[model samples]
Target chain A: MRLTSWGNLSLDDYQTFFYDFNPNLLAKIPKPVIAVGASRSYGDVGLNHLGSNLLTTNLNRFINLDGNLVTAQAGINFAELEKVLNLHKLSLPVRPGTSYLTLGGAVANDIHGKNHHLQGSFGCHIKSMRIWRSDSGVIEISTQREPDLFFATIGGIGLTGLIIDVTFEATEFLGNQIKVENLVFSNLSEFNQINQSSQNYETSVSWVNISGKKNGNGIYSRGNTVPEFAKKITKAPISYPKNLKLNFINSTSIKIFNNLYQNLQKSIKISLVPAGKYYFPLDGVNNWNQVYGAKGFYQYQSVVPEKNAYEVTEEMLNLMKEEKTYSFLTVLKSFGDKSSGGLLSFPMAGLTFAIDLQNQGEATLKLMNQFDQIIQRAGGRVYLAKDARMSREFFESSYPNYEKFNSLRDPYFSSDLSRRLLGF
Target chain B: MSKILVIGSTSGIANEAIKIWLEQGNHIHLYARNHDKLKMQVADLEIRFPGHKIDAFTFEANNLSKTLDQISLDNFDIALITVGELKYSDELVGQIQVSEKLINSNIQIPLAFAQTILEKYKTQGYGKLGIIGSVAGDRGRGKNYLYGASKAFWETYLEGARQEIWKNKNISLSLIKPGPTNTAMVQGRELGNLRLAKPEAVAKVIVNGMERGKSVIYAPKIFQLIMFIFKIMPIKIFNRLSF
Candidate 1:
């Protein structure tokens, strides 16, 4: 088996099987240890396991679309998947923060898109899957054949078995561009009220420009839904990312980077845009991690319930301010809802703030540790996906119902991503 | 039937080995730099296997005195030191300070822990000790020879400590020399097609070697044979293929 990473990977150790296997042809190997998706599914949930040969690059064929039922190999990417779905005038229900995941990966991680509350998780729409169980060997499962494994496989972290191909129902899209409106929240609390007050919109997420400050802190959000008056355009739309550059700098660098960025943003006017443009604003700048420089960066994304938002975010911001750590990317989004079956699923009708911390040495860990304490006190758990390193105890303490999650996990079907983070 | 204390819980091998102890319903104490990541693990074990007691503590495992004091209450039957330094970038190749820290982190600190813990285990009349040594320790090669030197010293120290104490006292010490296990430590680094063992495979070998009362184990079994061949090769020829 061969192994290669996505440069330094979006996070780290994004293990993907570097083989090509056609469903038409049989295997000389065990289906790439278990195929890993586009790797956008944070954590090692999408990583290949030990002694397991993976088929990643080769399994990315997206062939044939029968109505809303799209059939794809394990490696078909989400961006391309979205493009195909849009071609059929449809969209996946829950889109995780990124659209780079494979259909198999999205199912494995059960990714939740921006409009989670209205739709539930990504697994809600999945009809069935063609799986190759290491123990039972290949079988097609849905709500019937091996239904326990199927339900468990939904957010199973790809542990139930290897997914060779997937077929899920898709939501129809209105037009190329969603009618988007920009709502700049002066603070987190304001974002909360506005987010809660509105629900009729098709999609909503707050883009927080949180820099560890009280005022002028929070998101520059964009909410969009299909409008009846919108004209249908035949041409495919393009999205330019706001740039996911978490610029790491000393005091000198911080001032220059923030000043230039803020000034540039002061002029961008409100307008309707493509759904991709509205959602993945930072997708344009390729290798956006370069902004953090050679030291690399840490993306800290945590979900805190609305009740604890004030106290928690206050302490969170206060701690970062005290630490004097500057990050170019800090986003606050009000989560919608989630399914009951999702064991370790994020968001319980709360606000999640994601920030990128450039490696500023021990200080970053200390601040995160401090953030961990506040989050723990305020009843919040850190997101396992974006986390490269976190104490196992803290992870367990936050996730008290892990016994429930662990019970669902197939003994042989443990995720490499969760295993590494937990050091198991 | 041994309740053990795994000092360096972050080791890939140690983590898998701990699972066996958990399965045996043995009380295992997990220690590492980060506590949150392991809470889910130890907690689940504690809850799932109610009889299996798992306690975790976050400490600078490199600090012998601090670790010894913190773990005083838990009189462990085994002390497995899996902490070591593995650096891939050339940024630390020649830097004496960096090398010194690596040696201290991998060798000196573990040495201190061994000296303190082994004395207690010896006095107690029974103990098992395993270290996650590497094939790099089998002999110095061009790549990461400094790390090899540290592991080599550890292997020698463990051998001496084992010999100094009478074998009949029921003390067992095993040096785990796994060739190159597929671990996060070697994720993106270049390790030129050596037979890399899996973490579980390494753990299984270590557990078996401990059960058989073997002193040193080359993980995956094949690496032992491979290293045996490498050990006797002439220095001139070995040096040619060092890297």
Candidate 2:
């Protein structure tokens, strides 16, 4: 089967095995395999190009739900989990931009969301997990038991083992509606000020215009779950036609789209939106990446410490301007001080910027390398989940705990990312 | 709320169908071959649909008679039989054990279970029954004719049973003929360009058709026409074509 990350980059053929509800099946699958859930990661972190890719989507099933705590199989995506939680008037403490991400993916990536400032990354809420390792066999781990392995596995990028199931705490929510407020920031400085002011809000993020025409100018939005109950609405996603061969997204179109989006949001100060629409707007347009063309796109997400955040971001924007590169979607947000237990966790107390650059092939790669240099100098690390291209030296430097995580990795399990960065 | 009995409840299609029925406020009774798997499935269903009644029983084919005898079927308003096995082999004569297992799983066991359910439904005076057959049953193909032949037996058996219950307005039976569905049964098969229907979608159609009292249903609805075309094709042309 041909597999690619959510970025649609690094497409390659792989021998795939579906994870049926049996641990013994793991032993049968030829190793150096990686377990993939939804393959929502933007890079090759979920891709096992050299070996088998264990598709865990079929492993989806709820194990138990007691009050606010929920235990479920690794393959159960947040979209399904949210629906079940909504039934009990509960909401996930932390959720990524897209609900299509499976629990295993979330834990592996240690994903952060709009509520990161208050709730921290997804791994923070995880109570325990059952993982199947080729070297160690099936074992259960948590903070109280095998703490080192437990922490390493949290953001271990599926190299630690294949997560079987996870138990997590879900917080209570009043309703399915979010009262959202959009505010505009003229620059990175202004955006930081506004972000600080909106810290009380449960969710906060900004869509920056990285075309360099406006530098750091963007729309900053903050939202919180409204107290009043609203009926859950489900609209069938519109899928992009597979046969369409043309790329509709370009620098010209991206600029036009960004300007139009900003202008449209200028008038909308506050409104009530469904949680799904607020959290996963892109999900409403299935295969939205197809618009980027067959060449696909690269999502570069990096987090820098708070002190260097402004300077590093300004340098990145200037670099993009110098290179004449345009990003279709540029998201900027802040991470809270609450650190995750995952040794290789991406989120830290810093400001993070994620931009989707159209694959201009060599030009894009060169530009990304420049951004990587700026980030590395500022003591920042590119998110492995969204990185398709990053040097091994930079990876080791960025994640000081990399050696420890490497020591704990399941020898029989490997991924394109691990092979590229760790040389396994 | 109605009581629903689902045999082979752990199968992908049956599990999905049971979820739909449960969501519609139906209490479910599950029966599967694996005790541990059945327990896990029951726990999963219980967690997903809290406050709903869910009971499960595990039984092997040989002890199926004793298992059926132990559980009362009078309360179940609907019964869905989704048990079957699919084995592909070109060397039929040499693989006696494989052939026997396929026959026992796909034909004998399901037929016996269906007979027991039909008899109970007749005695209960009012009940709905759905048995999952396959599109392959319309005409045996070279790839999996043994499995196809077993389904053909179901087509004939259901046809006769439909006739028996035609006069009884309270009793109904539906033979669900699903095309290639993306389930564990067809997971590893080389489906070529054939698009497998989602088990959830197939289950929805099956449950809906059974509720509406349809005698026969081809899930995805496209299979009915495809099967008709195949059924009318000349033997020479059919022989030349390979799946």
Candidate 3:
């Protein structure tokens, strides 16, 4: 069977297996497998190109929920978890840009969102997890118990083992309402300053325009949860029309969209919005990625240190302008000093930016390679979860601890990313 | 808050009705043949609606009499019967054993369970009973005569029961005849020409009919007109028709 992740950049044939509710049925699948959860990763991180992918989407179930903790099967995604948690006035501490990612996928990717400046990545909030190892039997690991395996598995990209269930701590919220403030920014420096001044808010992000006309103009937004007593408690159905898929995101269309988006947000000051609208705006239109035409698109995300943040981002934006490249969405977020225990966790005390560009064959690949060089010069690293093509040497140089992680990886478990980087 | 019992709870129709009742802060007991799926579904329901009480049991609906005896029902206010089986293969038309099993699953089992529940509710003098019937039962078609025959039997049975039970103002029985609905039972069948009703929409009709003390309901509303036309059609014309 052929499968493509969220990026839709590449589709490769894979051997997929489903493990139902029966526990004994899991042991029947062949070894050398990569456990896939929702297959939300942009690249081949969730796909085992050489072997089979043991799909865990069907194993979704709520195990338990205590005072401030939630235990759910790994197959459960944030979309399902958020619905259940909202009923109890609780919310996830660190949610990614998209809520469709599975719990296991979040752990494997160690995803971070606009709130990363405070709560760190998703792995930082996990209390404990259970995994079915190929070398060993079923095992429960945590930061205190099996620290080595736990840390390795936390952004291990499913190379460690098959994660069965996860127990994580969640935050109690007033309601699903959020007070948002959007401010127009002039350049990269202004965006950084705005992000720094908005430390009091729960979430902060910047939307940039990278086309030729208004290249550096953007809007910086900050949001905080509405107070319990003041919240309106408006519940709207999260339905996306199936007919909204439009393959109109070519060079011409994106340029028009970029201008319109910048103009729309240039005047907005403050408003109250739903948590879903504030956190996952792309979710408003289902399969929003299909707008990038039949060939799909690629996301290039890189994080540079505080000192090189302004210069590195400016250079990359200038390069895109010089190349006459077009990207529909260019998002920027700042990371906090609080690091995750995951051995290969992506976030650091730096500035991260993600740009979505349509895949135009060799031209797209060449442009990405150039961006990689610029990022490497600024001592920045690419996020593996969002990467479709990054050199193996660059990956090794960026993550110096890869050797230790490789040694702990399950002998029978492998993925396309691991095969590309570690020559497995 | 009413306590409800849902039979064949794993079916799409039963699940949608369960969600509506749970959202209203009602307690529900789910019964299905697959224990593992039932447990997972029950846990999911509990998580989705924390304040409501939810429980699950594993037993075949074909033997509902033996199954119901094992479950407790002290203060149950409503019962929903959504158990059914569909056989569409042309190969099974002349097979006597297969047809008999289909009759048992679609007619005998549900009828027996409905009769037992109606008797118990008749004594209680204040309860709601909901049974699912298909619009295909309106007129026998050559394509799916076995399924049509079973549901046609249920319509007659329900009509007679409604006459006997409707004298009591407190007791209500709903006969829901849903049109072509999107479900696993009709997976491979073409539905381009027929208006496909969502299971959620059909489930709502069933629940609403029971709430309004309605004895008969044709889901999607248009099915009522379609069925009326079928009922009035001449025997000569109906016999010659394929559908």
Best candidate per lDDT, number? 2
Largest TM-score belongs to which candidate?
2
DockQ leader = 2
What are the per-residue Cα lDDT tens digits for candidate 1 across B149-171? 88888777887887798655588
Native A-B contacts reproduced, model 2: 0.28
lDDT of 2 by residue, A225-265 (tens): 88877766667989998658689887788778878888888
lDDT of 3 by residue, B109-220 (tens): 7776677778778777778888887887888887787888888887788778878876888888888788876555644333334446777788888888888978788887
- In what order do the candidates fall by lDDT, top score first? 2, 3, 1
Those runs of model 2 whose alpha carbons end farther than 4 Å from true positions after fitting are A211-213, B70-75, B90-95, B186-195, B236-242
TM-score of each: 0.56, 0.95, 0.77
Give the DockQ (2 decimals) of all models: 0.01, 0.42, 0.17
Model 1: chain A TM-score against the true structure:
0.82
1 or 3, which is superior by DockQ? 3
Residue pair clashes in candidate 2 = none
For model 1, the superposed segments whose C-alpha errors exceed 4 Å read A1-34, A41-50, A53-55, A212-216, A226-256, A259-269, A407-416, A420-424, B1-243
